[model samples]
Target: MTLDPLPLAQALIRCRSVTPADDGALAVLEAALAPLGFACHRLRFGAVENLFAIRGQGAPHLMFAGHTDVVPAGDAGWSVDPFGGEVRDGRLMGRGATDMKGGVAAWVAAVATVLDRRPGLPGMLSLLITGDEEGPAVDGTVKVLGWLAAQDLVPDCCVVGEPTSKVALGDTIKVGRRGSLNAAITVHGTQGHSAYPQRADNPVHRLVRALAALTAEPLDQGTAFFEPSTLQVTSVDVGNPATNVIPPSATARLNIRFNDRHTEASLTALLRDVLAREAPRHTLEVSCSGESFLTRPGPFVAALERAVQAECGLAPKLDTGGGTSDARFIARHCPVAELGAVGATMHQVDESTPVAELRALARLYARVIEEVQG
Candidate 1:
């Protein structure tokens, strides 16, 4: 029997596996893949759950990676249960229908189709499913990758099933992702009556000057495959309600989305230099999530282009303009690209995917598998 992605997609949607929670999502996957002769291994890192399943062996291994976790369904105004997995008005409705439990279901069904046809295809097929992609990401793909490397199970090429399409299923494939960094700076000053001009130094003034230095100019102009780096001040707080007194300190938070022209170290150094000059007495805390990366266009990318054109009749545009995904983690080990369903409803209320689009994505992934392992 040919595997249909619809039922599996619905089954996955029914699991309330919101970030850091398995909620039996991995069990569902294990049941599906074990029937197809996959060797499934459940890896638990801290409170996070991960799965690694492989079928077949030898050279030219192709791995499909995704996360089962979904962001929380916020305040409820949904027309259906967020975990109901209801099929209504031609859409599969749920929390992860698009980003990206639906994508995972499609790839699994595609693998089933390939196996049924060849049964013993000349190469290997594997999956790296994580439960922490929507969380801190410290315990997910990063840790599994180390295990894969130690076991010598790295693939020749990998495809991360993140929702990459903007307007249509095959319209865009993410070739790279910008790096993300967050910084919090606190400026110290003396607290005193506001009327005393020289008796108190206003930390808020210092904080504003420091931020001005950081945002004074663009990080850089656009690169060949990336847009210019951007920094946004998210918050500034003094928390003082007294109008007559100057606050002792001020804090500001900033987030940066950067491209290949910069690294975390380079950006941090720049930030320190600015703070030192503009706000002489301050403490800064920095957090770097994923560094910028790219997979240069090559045979693997060409094959995906051909597959997408043949399946969807559209030339997929290679892009590097999105928030980071597990592709960043995979990029460190192998050439990886991200292509999946339209992301119109990824993290919003009534997060959903059209039934027709879900099935079409299944066909698209099947074509990718064929082209890569042919």
Candidate 2:
């Protein structure tokens, strides 16, 4: 029998699997997969829970990657309980209804749907699921990938069940994602009386000048498969409450969502060079989420496009204009792409997906499974 995705989505949603907290979410999914002949591996790294399950072995190994973790529900004005998994007026409502959980359920149902029609799977099928995608990501997919490397179990390709669709299911598939770099710039200066203009070397003024120089130019015009790089200042801090005192130190945090034109090293050098000219005395600290990567339009991408056209009757647009995802990590190991439900409500209040849309997504994923193997 083909598994209905609705009930499965609800069951997963009801677990309250917020970031870094399993809350039986992995158990619920592992229990479901074990009955279908999957050898489940529950790997815990630090405080994060991850699951990797495989049903077959050898060539043409295909992996479905996702996370069961959902972001916090935020405030208290929901029409329904954030974790209730209630369906009202033909919509399934919950914290993870669209951001994920729903997509995860749909993919599992797709596996069942495909298994029902054929005597056996055409190739090895596996799932790399983590409960840390929505958190620090320190011990999530990054860790499981290390384990997979140790066992030499890397797949041929992967499809991440992130909510990539924009207006409808299967309307868009991300072929690549921009690189992300976070930089913290702190400028130290001399504090003095505000009345004496020459007595103070104000750090805030120096910080603003450095930031102005940084934002003065476009990172690039953009690339064919990617968009122009963007730098956004997330926070600026002086922490001084007095209006008459010149602050001695100022700090600012900014993020750059850059295309393949730059890597973490190159971008750091660019920032440091600019700061040297604009604020020579500033100290800089930087971290990287992941470097930009693209899976060129080849067999892997063609498979997903064909699947979307077959199920949704429209040619899906191949895009790369989104924030970072776990696909960045997978790209190092195998070709990867993303497709899932419409993401209009992801990470917002009263997040939800229509009942019919959820079912249709399962059908789409089932087709993707078949199209990729051939």
Candidate 3:
């Protein structure tokens, strides 16, 4: 019996599983997977719920990784309830309808379809679902992958079902992601009256010069499969109310989206060097979300391409452009790629996915599993 992804998706959406909150979303999935002979294991890490379920135990293992969490549904106006999981005009509407609950349901339905056809197929299939992807992301796939590795349950390759498509179902597949680095720089100086320009050091001037040097040139002209790296100054503040008093310090926050051309360490070093040259007395602090990574074209990627063409009738463009996802962590374990539904309305008011597209995505995932496991 083939499972309809709509009902499952609706059930998932009904659970207000906002970031770091399970709200029984994982339980809903576990219920569906359990009846399919999957051995489910619930793993909780620091207030986050996660599940790792396996249907088989052998080589040529394939893992499906995703999250059940959705970003907060802001108080923005909506035609339907954000958590109601309403289906109107052949589309399922909810907070996570497209960003991922739809993809999760599609994968479950696809697995059900595959196993119903070949109940005794060789090799293993598993799911690594987390409830922390939309939150801090600290206690999710990264932690579960570690547990799986300790148990010798690492898969050969993993597919993250993030909303990777651009315009159509198979139009694009994310093969990599740009790294994110955030920095806070404070320029120190002696404070004094505004009239005494020569006596008092102006930190704001030093800060402006430092930022000018940082933004004077492009980080890089981008790289193959990725766009040019970008740096944006998020804020510059002296926090002084008195206009006549020169502030003692100036602080600025900056963020950089870098391609594979630079590592977080290298970029930090570059910034530090620039600070030294521009503002010798400035203090700096840096934090990295994740380093950029790419899975260069190979047989695994070829399998994805073939699956996309055969199932969706579209040759997917192998892309490496997007914000960081769980794929960044999975990339360290194996060659990872991301593919799923069109993300046109993810995290927006009236988030939705067409029922027809849901079924097509199921077929696409089924084909991908077959091609990768064959």
Candidate 4:
């Protein structure tokens, strides 16, 4: 019997499993995977619920990685309840519909269909689903991968079910992801009357100069499969209400979306150098979400490309552009790629996916499984 993705998708969407909260989402997935012969283990790490379910015990293991967690629905109004999981006019609407619950359901259905056809197929299949992808991410895929590695259960390759498709169902596949870095700079100066300009050191002016220097030029011209690195100043504030006095300090926050051409170390050094040259006395704090990583075009990537072509009829374009996903963590273990539904409204108010696309993605995943196993 073929698993109906729509029902499962709806079931998942209805969970309201906002990040760091399972809200019964993992339970739903466990129930589905159990009947399929998978040995499910619920792994909880630091307030996050994660599951590692596997069916066979052999080589050429293929793991499907995804997060059941969905971002906050926000106060923005919506046509349907964000957790309603309503199927309106052939569209499944909910929080995780496109960002991933739809993809996870489709993959589960694909596995069910495959097992039905070839119950005794060689090799193993596993699902590494996490409930912390939309949150701090410290307790999600990264931790799970470590646990799997400790048990010698790391898959030969992983396919993260992040919504990688841009316009069409199979138009793009993410082979890599750019790195992210955030920094906060605080410039200190003496507070004094604004009228006596010489008596006070205006930190705001120094901060403005530092920001201008940081944003004056492009980070790089980009690489072969990635776009140019970008830096944006997100916030600049003194938070002072007194108009006649200069504040003692000015703080600014900026973020960088960088490519593989740079590492967090190199970028951090560059930033520090920039501050030292421009505003020598300023204090700064830098944090990195993840460094850029690429699997490079190899045998594993080729297999994925062939699988996508065999199933979707369209040759997918290999891309590395996007916000970070679990693929970043998986890249550390083995080659990883992200391929799923067209994410037209991933985090929007009416996040949704068409029924047809969901099934097609399942077929695509099944084909990928076959290729990887071979």
Candidate 5:
């Protein structure tokens, strides 16, 4: 019961796992879990690494899901090596420290602690970890869930370690997530001299008109249990370097984070309608990352709330405002939620978590396992 998550967490952060690259990150986790009796399955799918480690069986299955991938450490300077896993001024400094290697470590250590107290759990305990989370996500949790379903290993309920906490280690629990869709619009027109604007069809002008209409109206008033659906244009490309020559085509990319009121199909139709009206000759390509999902308040939620209240002394707020995560994939298989440590610095330079908070989060996961199992 005296397990410290710091060592394991540091080991994970040191792997330099920038998405789709394991760099031995999964092996580090497997090493930590194997001695504790977990059957670690190293799953590789199309250059992406994943793991499904479980130690128990039967009803009330509690799965701790997370990712080992970290985003690239950009040009932003950090006092410590991004992969050094240094502890300075009580903070664990690294790329994945808080955004999630920290959470994954906490859960593993929590399991070790719980096992020390209760060697044999009454039900199943598992961990579904993926290395493709920060990448295209095609070869991660979604595929793992398929394999789990095929083998009848799907869990009863699950929690994703996605650093949902806003101000403190346990201040927030994400109960649902808005769906995500990415759109690419390419408007084509005949190339012409810039001096002859009236002679050539201007694709940039058409593209801007379409984008304006898409953003002119709000997706919706905020929905209960969710913020309003949002659409944002992320990129605009013409590929033409010369200002004197009119571009033959203009391309724009946009994303929509929508609520349960809309599905990918509905949102896609809406986008097409606007594009057809404004840029009839354009081509639109759309891919849905996830449709919005909500796990309604019930016994599972109550158990997580009780765990936070007891361990952290704060009644955690059940929230649903955030970008998409692997939770969106798990929600399709079972009731899933998100919880972990403070995320104020995730995906930023100097991303980190206090050593004290990491220990506290492990204790919280221990409590959560107890609450939900009973």
Candidate 6:
């Protein structure tokens, strides 16, 4: 019997599993996979619910990675209850329809389809589902991966079911992601009256000059599979009440999305150099979310493209333009790629996906499983 993703997708969407809240979402997946003979292991790390399910062991292993956690549905404007999981006008309407409970359902259904036909299974199939992808992400895939590594459960290649398609279901595949870096800089100055010409150090001028040097030149023209690095100042604050007073200090926050051409350490050094040269009296703090990663067009990627071409009739374009995802963590374990449903409604009110498109995505995943272990 061919498996359909609609029912499972609806079931997951109804769980109200907003990040750090299991709300029975993993239970829903556990119920579905257990009946199909998968040995489901519920792994909870730091209050986050995660599941690692597998049917077979050893070589040619294929893993499907995703998260059930949906971003919170804000007040109003939703035609249907965000957690109702309603099927309205041939669409599966709910909070995670596209950002990814829908994709998770599709992969499960695809596995069921393949197993129902070939009960013995092909190679091995595993799933890494987490509940914290949309949140701080410290306890999700990154931690689960450590456990998988300890247990020697790493697959030869992993596919993250993040909604990678931009226009249609199979038109795009994310083969890589840019690195992300955040920096906070505080420049100190002496507060003094505006009338005194040389009384104040004027931190605002120093901060502006520092920022100017940081954004002076493009990080890079562009990379082969990634866009040019970008640095944007997100916030600047002085908080001085009096107009004549030169603030004691001014702080600015910046975020950088960089291609493979740069690493977090290299970028941090660059920022420091700018501050030292332009604003010597400053303190800098930096945080790196994830480094850039790319699963170059190899045999595994060719197989995925072939599956997309066969199942969806479109040659997938390999892209790396999106923000960070769990794939960044999975990339540290093995070569990973991302392909899933259209992300048009991800993280928005009344988020939904067409039932027809979801079923097509299930078929696409089935083809991917076949190609991976064929």
How would you encode candidate 1's per-residue C-alpha lDDT over 1-374 as one tens digit per residue? 37889899889888899989989999999999999889999999999999999988787799999999999999878989999899999999999999889999999999888777878687899999999999999999999999999999999999999989999889999899999999999999989999995999999999999899888899999799999999999999999999999999999999999999999999999999998888888999999999999999998898899889999999999999988898898999999999999999989999999999999998899899989998
Model 2, residue 304: C-alpha shift (Å): 0.4
Clash pairs of candidate 6?
none
lDDT of 2 by residue, 155-205 (tens): 999999999999988999998999999999999988988898598899898
Root mean square deviation (Cα) for candidate 4: 1.8
Q: What is the C-alpha lDDT of each candidate?
A: 0.93, 0.92, 0.92, 0.90, 0.93, 0.91
Error of 2 at 122 (Å): 2.6
User: Residue 305 CA error for candidate 1 (Å)?
Assistant: 1.0
Q: List candidate 4 stretches off by more than 4 Å.
A: 74-76
Model 3, runs deviating above 4 Å: none
lDDT of 6 by residue, 1-374 (tens): 55678888888989989888989999999988988778999998999989999988667889999999989999898999999899999899999999899999999999988887777765789999999999999999999999999998888999999999989788999999999999999999888887883988999999999988888889899978888999999999999889888888999999999999999999999988888898899999999999999999998899999999998888999999879999999998788999999998888888999999999999999999988888
The CA-based lDDT of model 6 is what? 0.91
Steric clash count of candidate 1: 0
Q: Which pairs, if any, clash in model 2?
A: none
Q: Candidate 5 versus the native: TM-score?
A: 0.91
lDDT against true structure, model 1:
0.93
List model 3 lDDT by residue over 1-374, tens digit each. Answer: 58989999999999999989899999999999999889999999999999999988687898999999999999978899999999999999999999899999999999999888878767899999999999888999999999999999998888899999989999999999999999999999999999998889999999999899999999999887789999999999999999899989999999999999999899999989988987888899999999999999998899999999998887899898878899999988988999999999998999999999999999999888888888
Off by over 4 Å in 6: none
Reference-based lDDT, residue 271, model 5 = 83
Residue 167, candidate 5: Cα error in Å is 0.8
Off by over 4 Å in 5: 189-205, 236-249
